[model samples]
Target: MLVFIDESGDPGFKVSKGSSPAFVLALVAFSDRAVSLEVQAAIDAVSKQLRVFPEFKFSKSRPEIRDAFFDAVLPFDFCIRAIAVQKERIQSGYLRSNKEAFYSFFVKSMLKFDNGLLKDARIVIDGSGERVFKQELSSYLRRHTEKGAIRSVRFSDSRNDRLVQLADMCTGAIARSYRDNRDDADRWRQMIKAKIEDVWDFR
Candidate 1:
């Protein structure tokens, strides 16, 4: 299946000292046809649960989203995974820099299932950090895929393709998860870790 991985928050590296609880990443997977329906349904559910529109602008006041959003989104026909890295973990060397840690987490988890989609998948990820995120992920997929080739995937804000917007929704979820449970940092980390490793295959 094609996966679109995106991150939310500052990855703890944004600010050196003050409450560095901003690093979070969510890895969302989708089959070709399932992307649109599955993502929108989950988003709509979250919006309804919160009584606030999902399209809340970045500059707008933050809205409280229910945890059910994450819980409900995971059981779709397509796979959905999230990783919420805390600043404390990174500062303590528990996790690498945000991008590198996400690369390791995503490639390792995603490469496990040898489905029809993985063999000829078109992975779409959000644009981040000089577009290095997309390029690095494409490279990892090439190295790991059976044919060593990832189909055409681009990273941009262009609404022509709906996956980009879906990815942003997933990113919002990850950020919300971290922001909601700032006191239970370890729990959040473990929850994220378990989800990512749940589908891991070493072969």
Candidate 2:
């Protein structure tokens, strides 16, 4: 199994000052390697058709392009699991102030809630933090997750991994649903709703 992880919104708790009101982490899982390749090929085809960059980022792409990207990939075989956290609802100071801790907490939370779906899965998270931090995160996940369920954990640049980009798009769709400004939040979501296995709201 292959799992791609990505996030939307900042982990900072200063929602009133400048932080995002909600933080979202999404996991995209592919049970078959052939289906994974098919999805990558579809993304490549869509990017070429739209005359855009090879990498499709949810935050950077235009609304129409975003819609097109989702439309292109919805037919593939994969499952999405996401966790949307309302920052305001979190009262724990440690979780609120510590970015890495908060990230590790939610990432583990999402995987744990998956039951045994992630067993023996290889996880690729969007490369963000420093090397040591990534190492720590990997260790933390392996130590806490179901025994032998996680085969390996690694980091990859989203620009280089189309599946990670897909996770970003999925995370963006879920995060937008919690935003008051995005009136068309459900539009992209509805298009791919059947593929979304779970969306946990942390309230």
On TM-score, the candidate that comes out on top is: 2
lDDT of each: 0.50, 0.90
Please write out the lDDT profile of model 2 over residues 1-203, one tens digit for every residue.
99999999989977778998889999999999999999999999998999977688887889999889998999889999999999889999999889999999999999988967887899999999999999999999988888877999999998888899999998888888876777787777777799999899987
Assess the local accuracy of residue 149 in candidate 2 as a C-alpha lDDT between 0 and 100: 77
RMSD of 1: 6.5
**Local lDDT at 154 for model 1:** 54
**Poorest 10 consecutive residues of model 2 by lDDT?**
179-188
| RMSD for each of the candidates | 6.5, 1.0
Number of the top lDDT candidate: 2
Which ten residues in a row are the worst by lDDT in model 1?
A: 194-203
